[model samples]
Target: MARNILPLHKRDKTDTPSTRNASTIVPSEQAPSPSHEPKHHHQPHRPRHENALHSYVNNFWRNEIVAAAAEFAGTFMFLFFAFGGTQVANTAALFSDRATAGQENSGLTQAPNTSVLLYISLIFGFSLMVNVWVFFRVSGGLFNPAVTLGLLLIGAIKPIRACFCFFSQMFAGMAAAGIVSAILPGPLNVSTNLGTGVTPTMGVFLEMFLTSLLVFTIFMLAAEKHKATFLAPIGIGLALFVAEMVGVFFTGGSLNPARSFGPCVVTRNFPGYHYVYWFGPLMGTLLAFGMYRIVKIVEYQTVNPGQDFDDHEAAAFKPPKDAETAEQVGRPNVAALAVEEAVEEAVRIVSRGSREERDEEERIDGRLERGEQPRYVSERELLGRTGHGRV
Candidate 1:
């Protein structure tokens, strides 16, 4: 089946980014209430050029441009802090020791001091948390390609939008790296590679495991519709923090492929196994989806014992009565209910017909083509059986 690729304003069904303001700001004639009627209904029609310009601006703002711009801005902000924090920490450590020189002089020195580790971990983690909150309403706040990949695979985001997000994140990373490189001294080392003595195999495994944790955490918190959204960023941040604490020494704890790719793009420092950054996190995201499916299976069995999973029934979800009313009143762009209802009606009409039934339908169509009024055939007439009243 072709996936529906509706605009963000049209597709989102969640409570976040309430379209209430947009709707209320520009009340339409379709609004049922008299109080919502426009004050200038008698005004003359707009000029063709003005109408076209208005439509262009409205469509651009609500559909394509706004969300992509938000992603770009969010990704840029995230990478700025990420790269800047690493550089600042390294520079601080370098100056901390006068006798030390070269790579050992930086905060990224092999010793793995508690203070430096905590500082960098917290900085990256909290920076991600802040950006997620900032862009949550605008772009779903997915600053990582791994997260975007997971969402794409799970059918959460459209493939086209996911591609845009991936490009935005990578571009932001490159830009941030370039800026950091320009700001910091030439000799300072701020690459995202694994620490000294860490083998490529070990680094890959570490990245895989950490990214799995991060992606899985996002699935459990941010992606699930029933879960509270306000704390989703916090949960994601904490997951990153945990991953960094353990995986930092092994692979620089870079769960994000873009984060790893950025520094490499700037420094031209590609290891023989630099491909691990792409492979490991992507593989981890795939695994996270499998894990999420298992959880869903377990939950389904617990809630509906002895019943086989019905994909169609699950997909045809009806919101609660209050939710339906809330959506009608608050979200004007929500056309999912109408779309689903139309689809359901089409399916019902189609399912009631078989190959033999199609022949009957052709006869009815032929009669209609002849301009004769089509007669309704009751089930009893078709089955040659009497109705309950007649029998």
Candidate 2:
């Protein structure tokens, strides 16, 4: 479906530098209240454009910290579920075989091959869903470095903040995987084999392709802002599941480099698969960015649909001269105007009310007092009684 992209509006145009820079600050003007006027002020302060920019950049960094922390927590949780599931699956397979041998006379065997695949995929999928649910509202639910990098490429994220998110995700992934390894039972055969999910060279390429596809899906879903944001994570998880099912035989489906690196580091079995872990996922991230750019050009005519670069730049500068003086502004105070009109109308209505109207009001009041259903009042009458004019 074609998506609606919200246009970016600038709050201040003065602070923005002619040359675009990542660190530039943008300041927003506070609208003067109805009770205050520019002429009533004793003195007007000159705009401190540089100071405003400094504050803006500082606030941006503060928000970046919060975003990076969320990314860390989400990535950690994802890796914990993923690696923990792998451990449990491997152990189950081993015990299942042992049980089959014990019941040899029964001539029945439960291979657990399908079960393992299903469980692993589900673990990854569920992790993604939960993390995204928890963090989407806060940090856009970017739990992977590749996803963050793709956002940067499309200018959805500032370069500095994007770098922080990427590193945070990588470290968090590594830490979570290491922790899972420490708590699990000694090396299963899978762990001994470096826990590499697929064959080497082919696995790398597959990881690149699958990761790119996953990221591309995220961009498409995210562009549709009217839809629930939670769908991005669900879509991403399902994409991962499908890829796992198709690629598990060939490459173990390590679409995320950090996911691969974490287990390998803790197991102390890098085994030259490091090339795939890093290069493969990096290639995938770049490919995803490129694919998203192509799709964006074809679908939306812009690289990113919901971003507010113009607003960000405006926030860093001073207001323009043609802007109305704070005193001469004629915008009505909605709340105050509504209240005043309501009061005036209500007084007038009460002064003109008949005995019948009074009795009806009393009856309604009685019904409310007795917890019975009250008679519905007409909109005109209700508005008049509430001190608002006719609807």
Candidate 3:
């Protein structure tokens, strides 16, 4: 048992990074340290590649799936209520007992009743607003394929994400249509069809123009990311509402291919002008894309004229293409300009004070010259009451 014990050199506990660099841990179960600094814990450091992989998986794969699922559910919700309301609107008119043999088929074709048209328009608009408000945080509540395409073109979302969302919305549309068809006793009259006196050419153009308005609004309001972005659902819903009001009598206002495709599939009756919906939205997407790109390249905010922009207000906007806008905007010497303004204001105040002082002096001199009692000062030879070398 004659083992020699080596001297134990105690290590210094102070050999560690400062609290600024060290990790802070506060456990609720344990009492805090008396020293007003955070207690450090021994935790393993993760590799950069692991962090990179985690980010990629979460953002690229996991988020894409979650977004797609959200889009599916959101689309189903939007189209379900929309299709159900249409069914009600279309089916309710059929109960009219005043119909004769000479009268038109209201079920197969939308009736020209002003009340019904307004009802359908409001139903679609309000449904969109409500559902978008619900799912916007999840998948942006993009219930339309045209919206996904527009976002893709504007680089708001990746192409892969757009594809997933597009497919999800399409299938969801079909599901909504199929469910509505099953639950409702009447025909699935929600299909997009040309109205009276509407030609194929006219229908295509109508859809194109209508969809353009919608995509443009989304680009400006939602995708652009401004102080008013939270109000995007309202604006977007109203855009659809107005478009429906205007075009409901023309081409059934099929601004979305999913909306068109689902009804066609459920009824197994595709109109010859069915291509109109697809082509029109695609063309409109291109239009919105072109406008968005042009505005971005030209620095659209450059046209802001006579605006007294504050910190909370948006003084400028950038296109997704020019997101990294290297071009400097406004005066770079902001502090200097502020200082100059303050100096000018101070000068004005000083000048005003001097002018008032001069005027008071003039008034005092006038009273002195008049040799009046000058009631406010001593009445007996009151030259000393003034500052003009009075004695």
The candidate that wins on TM-score is 3
Q: By TM-score, highest first, what's the ranking? A: 3, 1, 2
Q: Please report, in order, the local distance difference test score of every candidate based on alpha carbons.
A: 0.71, 0.64, 0.77
Candidate 1 yields a Cα-based lDDT of: 0.71
Candidate 3 local lDDT, 274-331, one digit each (tens): 8998998888878888888888787665555214345522223222442334243432
Assess the local accuracy of residue 82 in candidate 3 as a C-alpha lDDT between 0 and 100: 89
Write one digit per residue (lDDT tens) for candidate 1, span 1-391. Answer: 2434664433233444565565666657655564654544354478655544465587644544566778878988887887788677666766786344225422243345666667778878988999998898888999899999998877888887888888988888888778878877754355556676888888777788899999988887888753266789998888888888887666677788888787777777676777878888988898899998888665532333313224543444443443323232232223576688789999887787666575665565566568665355553354233222132
Deviation from native of the Cα of residue 388 in model 3, angstroms: 43
Per-residue lDDT over 1-391 for candidate 2, one digit per residue giving the tens place of the 0 to 100 score: 2323443322222334552352334332444453554333233468755644465568777788888988898889887877777667756665767642211211111233676667767777777877787788888888877778787777778888888888888899779877876677756222212122346666678778978887787777774443355467777788878866655444556677667666666656665556775676688888988877766456542323323224433333243344334222222345675689799999888777866576666666666568665345573465367553321
Question: What CA RMSD would you report for each candidate?
Answer: 18.8, 21.6, 13.8
Of the two candidates 1 and 3, the one with more favorable TM-score, higher being better, is 3
The lowest-lDDT stretch of 10 consecutive residues in candidate 2 is 101-110
